[model samples]
Target chain A: MNAAVEIDVKSEAEAFLIAEARLLDAGRFDEWLALFAEDGFYWVPAAPGQSDPLNHLSILYEDKSVLGMRVRRLGHPRVYSAQPAPRTAHLVGNVTAAPGAEPGVDCEVRSTVMMAEYRPGQAADRRLWAGQQTHKLRRTPEGWRIVLKRVDLIDCDAVHGILAVPI
Target chain B: MPDSIAPDALRRLVLPDRVHRSLYTDPAIFDLEMTRIFGRCWLFLAHESQIRAPGDFVRARLGREDVIVVRARDGRIRALVNRCTHRGAQVCQAERGNTAGFACPYHAWTFGLDGALNSVPHRQSLPPDFDLKDPRLALAAVPRVESYRGFVFGSLAPGGESLVEHLGPIAAVIDNVVDRAPDGEIEQAGGVARQEYRGNWKLHHENANDTLHPGFVHESSVSAARGDPRDYAAPAYDGHQTHTQMLSNGFGVREWQSLSLTGFPAGHSYMGGFYRGGVLSPDRDDPVWREYRARLVARHGEEKTARVLGEDRFNNLLYPNVSINAQYQQIRVVTPLAVDRTRVTAFCFRLKGAPEALFHRAVRFLTNLSSPASMILSDDIEIFERVQGGLANSEPEWLDQSRGLGADRTEAGGRTVSAGLSELPHRAQYAAWLRYMTAAA
Candidate 1:
């Protein structure tokens, strides 16, 4: 691809990512939900490239139903952990694209994210969640939708305080 | 020298029926526990099956001390400190693996699976009087290490009761866990879920067998599962009431009074009661459950199978460390990090020959209801942290373990049980905690 075309592609991908982050920041979960493909996977590996979710564990390996359940849980006020509700600001950076595996499907884009969360009750109370994320984007009729969203947390094995929302 | 605790102050922290708040909240007491209790008690290490192969090894923490358990070429499992004797650099960094020998990243000092000093670079440069073959240069082994039914445990105390004797009546509890599999053994199958709670480690143990808190503290979960329209409710405690109102009103005074407690020596205990009529699988028609039931019955016989499967055990506290809930395939180990911080590692086990559905059910139950991400667990964690924070206040003299105090029925063994909502387990644990903390090292 030409340098100009590559720059345009990169900018477009960055815009898509920024929009997704905005949706999450605004607590527009349902709107963000629509940005994924029908068979898209939302995976947060216990370790990077965790192959099997069965024998090995994952922070999250949600399909449609599981994702739906989590979204529904977020709306439940009785979720004590969500009493005050966690506020998150997603900082996305360093977007890069790789070769596409197939035609009409753009290659994967990698980025780093730092999520700062606050809860009223926790001691040393604030957490700055850091992780590297990769998104496989496919050119849909409307625009680029996430086919796969993988999050690799820096402290995935460390005892987690509470994760009320999707990381 | 002034920082050292006087023996009298330590004695006053523990009583027969209750313990002072300092035991759980004081840093000094925590340090002493590391040296007195954790240092002396036989702590659960790792299962032998975890290192089935000749070269397999697993690294674990025994009371703030890091040790590596490796299967030697001769098939014997050896537990050795992870630290290299030369410069104290960790020999193995990985959580688990199969290796011929461990090499220190810092100096290339290598040790055999048995922790014998196998090689060191530049032996000629060493002093002529240096004795490389001396045992002191080898990796330090835990003072006492033993295995029962594939479960390995290590104790820093040089002399104590054998692992089996220390386990006492609780030995049956371990047997129940391994015997569930038709092959007459259990292996760690599904990967472990390690989570830390910012509260004292003992809180996890106390809460494990506290059947009374579930219905109340877990109201949100129970309501969500029931598909109720009402919002989730947090458990409320009425100081005037007989006991904490953590559980729903379902467990009335009469029912709480009638529950049985089986107390074994060394602080092990089991509380028996069915909370919500054991959970039924979502897919009742699945052939796996049927085959599992059949196999259980075949191996244990109808009476024993009913006892094992139907009996409700809120928590079987294996004092000092492990807690096994067979019905749920949940085993939790508490590793104390500080007075106010504990790392609780929960492992979900799979029956060796059971159906896949059985394992699936266990995963669903554990992850949905008990994992750190669960609403119920978060609530419990909140309360624990609150309690840990509150104990700093000088108001309360002692935390109550007086509930159902006089109601304990002494059985043939060292075990004792109280009503479903009784605090017998907590009291039993404190008693053992006191004994261990006070015993001469």
Candidate 2:
């Protein structure tokens, strides 16, 4: 592809990701939920290439109800972990699109992101969480919906503090 | 003997039914524990299945010391200190991976899977007599490394009971975990969740078998899971018809007193209590339970199956580190970072050859009730932190574990109490802790 054509595709993917990150950062969870297709999957693998969520585990492998509960938990006033609420800032970059396996399917995009979270009462420590994310996008009437969002955390296996909200 | 603890200091800290506050808040005591207790105990390394392939390794912590457990090419597993002897840099930084050999990031000092320093940069610069083949110069292996049914344990101490002997009556609990699988083996599955708690490590150890707190501390969770209409009725233990329901309902003094406590040697103990009302019961007709029951029957026959499955154990505290809840496929390890801070790693296992639903149920149980994010765990953390905070005060000399003391029954190699409300296990743990710490001194 020519440089201009590549830039155009990159801009489009970057815009979609920016909007998604904004919704989450702003705590507009319902708006963020609208960005997923009906059969979309949100996964944070327990380990890399964990194919079966049945036999293996995922930090998160939520289909609708589980995701809904997670979003609900973020707003749970009595959630002791969320008493002061968790603050997060997302820095997303390096969006690259690759050809989809099947024809007519939306392309796959990969990006690197760093999320810094601060939770009061838990600790004074502010952690800079970085990860590589893969998004399987599909063009829908609602612009672009995420078919799959996979997050690979740098410290997934290490001892973790409270993960009160989705990363 | 300043580096060594004084006997009077140790005595003042531990008592029959209560431990002095210093045991939880004193820096000196914490240091002593690192050398005396954790240094000598057969600390859990990693399950053998974690490093099934050659060069596969997992990093584990025995107290403050970090060690790497690697499977060698010849199929022997070795647990060695992660520190590179040349420059004292970590040889392997990754949490886990398969590698031909470990090369230190600092100087590229390479070590074999057996932890022998195989190569160093610019070997020509070294003196002719400088020997690299000496075993002493190799990554210092744990003094003792052994496995019981794939669960690996390491001890820095040179002498002690073997892994099997140390496990005592609790060995059956480990067998129960693996034997639940049709293949009679279980592997660490679904990954592990590590979390830190701002409390003494022993608090988590004690809380594992402290069945009384779950009903009260986890009342919110119990209420949530029990749902709305019955949530009000759930608080009363007497109303629940089944064991599971009553457990979730909240344990009153009378009900808690009815459970059994078995205290084994080496500080291990278990609290036996049925889940009231069967709320936590896996469906009998469920394919997973059917397979598990059949395997148990085949292995131990029908009568033994009843004894295994029907026998209720709320928590099995495995001395200084592990706590196994076999019924739930939950294993929690307490790593003491400091006198006031603890790191708990919880692993939920998948029973090999069992139905998918079985594993999912275990995941639910862990995430909903035991996870750091779980309301129950957070509440317990709050209480533990509060205890740690309260113990920091100068006034209180001892924390009580005196409940049901006079009623404890002496058993072979351990003590057992007929009633669940007994604090025999707590006392037993303190007793064992004193013995281990004092004897080592």
Candidate 3:
């Protein structure tokens, strides 16, 4: 590819990731769910450098449909864990992009993210989650959609408390 | 600590049907439990499969002690206190690894996999009376390390009931789990996912067999799953089992009451399985089920396979620290970290000869039920923390365990059986707790 094309892809990927983080922080889960391809995956592995989501345990490995259910559950009035919804600030930076591996794909984006979460009226429940994310983008007729998004937490194996929202 | 809290006073705190809130809030009582209960009980450690080869090790916790459960070169498994005898520094720093010996980073005091003190740097500088070969200079070994059906357990107490005796009739549940394996063996697969909650350790065990709480506590997950029409449609999605598992919590009063809840003498108990619908159902005729059934039948024949797969006990609580779901090939090990905090680590097992997909499904089961991101488990954890917060108040000193006190009946082999919604397991647990707490040490 030409240098101009590479620069465009890199800039586009960075913009896409920044927008995605904003959607999560804004609690627009339904709109966030629309950013995925039909068979897109959202994985949060329990261990760093974990490769197998099928044979190995992950904190979460949800396909698009499962993500739909999660979005619905977060909106439920009786959701005890989210009774007082959590407020999150997602900071994304250090982004880079490379061409996608397969055909009909755009590029692979990698970015570092630090998410701060605080539940209302529970100051002690505040948490700061830091991780690196790999988003595989595919160019669809509509626009660029995420083919796979994997989050690798710095403290992936740590004994965690309740993590109700997406990181 | 046990003396600090009088036996009679402790006994009074646990009546026939209710327990004092202090049991959940008092640090002194927690300390006593660390000695009497956790100190003496046969706590589940790493499985043999995790450290199958020589020199393989996994770090585990025995109450407050950090232990390394390792397989020695001589084919023997040993649980050694990870602390170095030289300066009380930890000998092993990694969670798990394959190493011939552990060398303390502080002073290079080396110890073998069998926990024998191998060598120490600057030996000549030590006093002449310092003997490297002396057993006292080596890392301390847990008094008793035993294995039943490849499940390793360690007890800190010098003398107590054997592992089998501690398990009692609950051993049958272990047998049923291993028997379901097509190759007659199961190995630990998938990594462990851990979650900590701000609640007493007893809360996990108390909630394990309580059937009534699911519909109330996990109502959000259940209702959300019910609201998803695609989950019940003819063409199922990839997360069909995940959705169905959550929906299973919506089991009604009649369905819950029809199941059996049995408690054994040794504070161990198991509740009958309730996932009898959708893809979570054992009788599902999917291709994966067909393949698994064929593999099991190949090993145990038709009738035996039927008997093995037919045993559907869920949440088999082995007293103080372990809960097993044989049907899902999952185990959740609970560790008490403080008076008001506990940690649970969940692992999945793969049947040796079963299809690879079966193990994948088991991994999914572990994630859905035990992962910190679990919709079902987060609710349970929220309730646990809320209970801890509520109990901090001085009022309502007693927590009820009387739901099924009079309904319990003793059966053959000294097992206490009750209705599915019964709190009989809590009573049985406290019965064993009082026995351990008040006994002559």
CA lDDT of each prediction against the hidden true structure: 0.73, 0.74, 0.88
Q: Mark the 10 consecutive residues where model 3 chain B has the least summed lDDT.
A: B230-239
Measured by TM-score, the strongest candidate is 3
Model 1: interface root-mean-square deviation in Å: 7.3
What would the TM-scores of all predictions be? 0.84, 0.80, 0.96
What's the lDDT of the predicted structure labeled candidate 1? 0.73
Off by over 4 Å in 3: B231-239, B276-279
Cα lDDT tens digits, model 1, A43-85, are 7766555666545456666554345545555666665666677
lDDT of 3 by residue, B134-223 (tens): 999889999999999999999999997899999987888789879988888999989998999999999999988888998889888888
Please state the Cα-based DockQ of model 2 relative to the true two-chain complex: 0.20
Residue A34 lDDT in candidate 2: 76
Docking class of 2: incorrect
The residue-by-residue lDDT of candidate 3 on A33-152, one tens digit each, is: 999998888999988899988888889999887888888999888888876888999998999999988875678999999999997743258899999999999987787899899999
The DockQ for candidate 3, computed on C-alphas, is: 0.77
What is the lDDT for B250 in model 3?
89
Please tell me the TM-score of chain B in candidate 3 relative to the true structure's chain B: 0.97
**Candidate 2 Cα outliers beyond 4 Å, as residue runs:** A1-45, A48-52, A61-79, A84-118, A122-155, A165-167, B228-255, B295-301, B364-366, B369-372
What DockQ do you compute for every candidate structure?
A: 0.24, 0.20, 0.77
Residue pairs in candidate 1 whose N, alpha carbon or C atoms collide under 3 angstroms: A159-B196, B216-B246, B216-B247, B256-B419, B261-B416, B261-B417, B263-B414, B263-B415, B263-B416
lDDT of 2: 0.74
